[model samples]
Target: MSAFARSFLKKSLLAASTLLLGMPALAEEAASASLSNPFICRRPSGAAGTITEFPLPTEESSPTSITVGPDLNLWFTQTGTGTIGRMTRDGAVTEFPLPTEYSIPQKITPGFDGNLWFTQLGVNQVGRITPKGVVTEFPLPSAGSSPYGIAAGLDGNLWFTQVTGNRIGRITPAGVVTEFPLPTPEAQPTAIALGAGGKLWFTEVRGNKVGAIATDGTLTEYTVPTANAGPSSITLGWDGAMWFTEQFAGKIGRIGADGTITEYALPDANSGPVDITVGPDGALWFVELRGNRVGRITVSGALTEYDVPTAGSQPAGIVFAPPGFLCVDPHLWFTERGSNQLGRIRAVTVP
Candidate 1:
């Protein structure tokens, strides 16, 4: 088997062994060996293979991106309500409204500073929220940057994308900010993730490419073979590759560290898969906004999809609880943008 397939094979076998033998499982869930492991595979414990949804307290809160916060609860962006929300697995929730009006926060990630940080796409800024629910907003130096995706970097900083500004942004914990211009103007860099070699990897939807940048501001870009693929969100796979969604192409694209790119077609031609995240079993899971389903795909390209209970809920982000959480009742939590609800696939249903 190819190295990519082997990566999936090892995790798949472990999942099966766990279900049948009732034994504990340990699977490495890191993208780059240089980075510390974030999440791990464990025997899933729950009632059954099912999905549950929790409605947001406010109307049209529009939960966008989700992450396992430092406190081991779920945190997400409420684009409509302009609030950052925290929710327990049991469906309890508390919201910290952003001070900025109509901020339209997009992607969120747990910061190394014991807080959650996110992008304010509408305001061209990044916002930080402490564990206690205090929020601080930091504006980008360049106006009209349209900051979108945000991820924590290995070097103790938060990195983000500028969909219109066409620049990659880095911000220190103290709120100091820096921007690097992409070689390809109008790349419309949408999402960012920490990838192999401690470089920050991101997707260029308009540029039809994926790119990586060293912490020192060195830049590199790789053209996706399929033109206008509209590569949206990106996540580092267990195979040491960067996997992303081709929103316009209706496919998933994997780019190796060497920049060799491969694309896999989803089962539905128009599923509109947007956000992706590494699951506990080492397989990648993503949200299909138009199809209203969550998809699980192995590194080898095999796929199994689970439908959302609410039709046209427009599931947005998918994230597994971090390793710090109690793994017994782990879940792959996601947001339902169209439904104003937070949802999750029971651990038992995940691969």
Candidate 2:
């Protein structure tokens, strides 16, 4: 546990004792309350936005990654159930099964070919699904590469991380595949994103570093400041820098085009921030798997967090939709891995 968490627990115990000494009835209520506060994301009437959730039709589906499709619908991976789920704006859900059983699909993104692509760790293949729900699969160059995170590159191809392959893999829209070896072995990369300057950036969770690959395939890696930080997600921030989450260290990290890295500690050092994205309001938003809350941070380092309505939701992935871009209700979307639900906070546009 972080020192802050230990200290907070100690103080809470002392305060509870004081309350129990005077008022037994009141002390019972206090004792039953959770140590950390939980709130459904909401603001005055229609100000910040209210949170809404849609439960999946199947149990233990374990949805992992979520993305807004070119069709303006939400697409997600059901790792547990081995299916791809699509939800309309009104919460109507449809599921499509992968061709291979035990596919163990991971992160997903809209591809340059007007389709959505995802990683299949269990079957060791890259899968694609058209907007019409047709499925296609391509095997990785090597066996058991464990392709995890994927993103559309500036070169009209898809780029993804090979968690165990120790290399970056790219697949063209035509299904031709190529692999680029990483200088560092066993990096265990987890998530990827297209960042500033048309470069594809990814997290090296085990290597404790962040790497960038130009469309031409030249790769460069920058070391994170903290040891064993376990960076988990990467995104292109509104400020023209690459922002990411340090899951192990409970910090939000930033890397500039020049490869300079900066880190900011969260209010709750044990929050275990997972996936991050750029919100419609131009701030960086992230999911706190351990904190059970969604956090927002500004370019200047100021932070704010809103608790998930479902206790122990264990939010795993997050994505942002711009106001009126495709539909009337723009939202900050996420997957509730623990609760088996998809969630969204109503989005407010900044004039």
Candidate 3:
């Protein structure tokens, strides 16, 4: 066999041996107990596996969103502790608290200005954090806006969703703020993504629709076929379309650039799909908060799931570690909300 296949086989056999020996303790404490050997191959082929329970220092941190920062270190938001965290590829971690009390930081993304930007759900504000951990907060014009999802826009500004304000917002790197009201009041716009043609697409949890807003503030909305689908998070697919999760309807929906809509039902009932991103392998990967599993879905509608070793772990945000900064093998890193750990999925391939 080839070198790659031989290495795969060796790992597979070793994992099988451990399971056959009934070493449940090893699996349970694999990550927290040992940082050097945090990886545990869960599949028989060893081609795909998960590293569970990678302990975060702060207990009950309740990490929400994760992204590869400009510095190439993994940065995430700790909702429970009201802080932002940075983790090195080698597993070292550091956290920075938001200046505003009870800010409830949400999604995070690297801004074009070489800094990290995030949303503050509890207080009506958007925040910017430098690589050196200097944080600055900008208050939204509307009170109780509750901004949730955020993304760097092509217009050199950050676009975000206002869940409580029922609007879309834009903030320049200089902190200038602007807002556009959605036609349907109380639509509860949850997630936002940069769509084709420099437009912004987002999900309306209560309004049961997907909407797009241009850089100049032109808004267009499309109704999802299922009522009260509760669309939560959205990301641009490898196919250049917008793919989103239906948290309440238990389905994944795709919206074409031409405004065509397609919905695929999840095989597992009530999985409660929360966050999604395009994986390193070019498939759409997502977290099932209630179902406690990591799932992958292809553009052609194929679905596969990897069970998280910790039951009720409530896996949250996910992102592919940037190339060359970490291991050669592509890995998907995520947060285990209930367990207060960082999870890793290595060697993921199209099966």
Best by lDDT: 3
Error of 3 at 139 (Å): 1.0
Sorted by TM-score (best first), the order is 1, 3, 2
Please give, for residues 1-351, the per-residue lDDT of candidate 3 as tens digits: 335434433443353344334333232222343333324322222356556468899999998899877665789999999999999857899999999999999999877677889999999999999888999999999999999999988777999999989999999999999999999989999999987788999999999999999999999999999888998889988678999999998898999988888998988759999999877566788889988888888999898888888888899898865433112234789988898888988635322
What stretches of model 1 exceed 4 Å from their correct place? Answer: 1-49, 322-330, 347-351
Which residue pairs clash in candidate 3?
Answer: none
lDDT of 2 at 350: 23
Residue-level lDDT for 340 in candidate 2: 99
Q: What range of 10 consecutive residues in model 3 has the weakest lDDT sum?
A: 22-31
Clash statistics: count for each candidate = 0, 0, 0
Model 2 ranges off by over 4 Å? 1-45, 322-330, 347-351
Q: Could you tell me how far off, in angstroms, the CA of residue 85 lies in candidate 1 after the best superposition?
A: 0.5
Winning model by TM-score? 1
TM-score computed on alpha carbons, candidate 1: 0.86
Q: Model 1 residue 243 lDDT?
A: 95
